[model samples]
Target: MKFNKKIFNLSAWITLLIAYVLPYQSQSSDGHSTYLGYPLSFLTINNTPIYKTLFMTESIDIFTLTIDILIVYFVMHFANVYLSKVKLNKGMNKTKDFK
Candidate 1:
């Protein structure tokens, strides 16, 4: 549960993969607004969804990809920290009981 280098690296790799897989398309079809390449047709505001699924489009939007990567990175980092803290607390409790 600790935030070791291995775990951090693994998460980093996963984040990179996600960013690469979810490409952002800039232009919207038929004057429809798009976030990355997905049409915002579903939303009333005519804005594309922030998250796009794989196999939706071939092109990649660099800007949106970067944003996704950063968001994932931060979330993973925070998760690691939280898990480590919980683990440390559990260990401390176990030692105290033994003593």
Candidate 2:
């Protein structure tokens, strides 16, 4: 079966959402970070997570999330375009060589 662009676009957006929104124990509880009085991304490096989850982190705003979603979608779309360009066969006269 042939692949379709919409399927890729949808899945790419979902993957981006997971990357930015999926909570990871990237930090520990010794320190604190805020995002409107709630926890945000952490800074995990070693076995001990290094950030507090509450009383120091900011809350999630939907507007910020919407913008992030759009940004992620565009990034994936552009990357797909770039890969397609790279996959094309060049027969001595590639389009990118022209000014």
Candidate 3:
């Protein structure tokens, strides 16, 4: 299999979609939401570095939320790229095995 730039691009786009589509919760009982690839929890809001303020405060900071989302998007994109490379490498190895 050949390395496809489109696949990497598609994965990035998907990551961005997921990051933005996931809702941000203001409290621990705001229902299900996701930021980046990890599920967001009101119970564990204190555990999040970016969400530490949510623990003490009821309001969400738009700036921090946006920055965190962007960070997560990049992390997911790079992870997708690396995984795709590994998959392509495995496919190439299998073809060689057949020969």
User: Each model's RMSD to truth, in Å?
Assistant: 9.0, 9.8, 10.3
- TM-score for each prediction? 0.49, 0.39, 0.43
Q: Which residue segments of model 3 deviate by more than 4 Å?
A: 1-57
In angstroms, the error of model 3 at 36 is 16
Q: How do the residues 1-99 of candidate 2 rate in per-residue lDDT, one tens digit apiece?
A: 334568456854564456445554443466443222112232222322447553333345555455555555566677776776767646335666783
lDDT of 3 by residue, 1-99 (tens): 344456556554554455445644433345333333223321222334564565453334455545555555566667777998999999999999999
Clashes of 3: 1
Instruction: Name the regions of candidate 2 deviating beyond 4 angstroms.
Output: 1-21, 24-60, 90-99
- Higher-lDDT candidate of 2 and 3: 3
Ten-residue stretch with the least lDDT total in model 1: 36-45
lDDT of each: 0.52, 0.48, 0.51
The candidate scoring highest on TM-score is 1
For candidate 1, write residues 9-58 as lDDT tens digits.
66556655543345344445765543332221111123345585434434
Runs in model 1 deviating more than 4 A are: 1-57
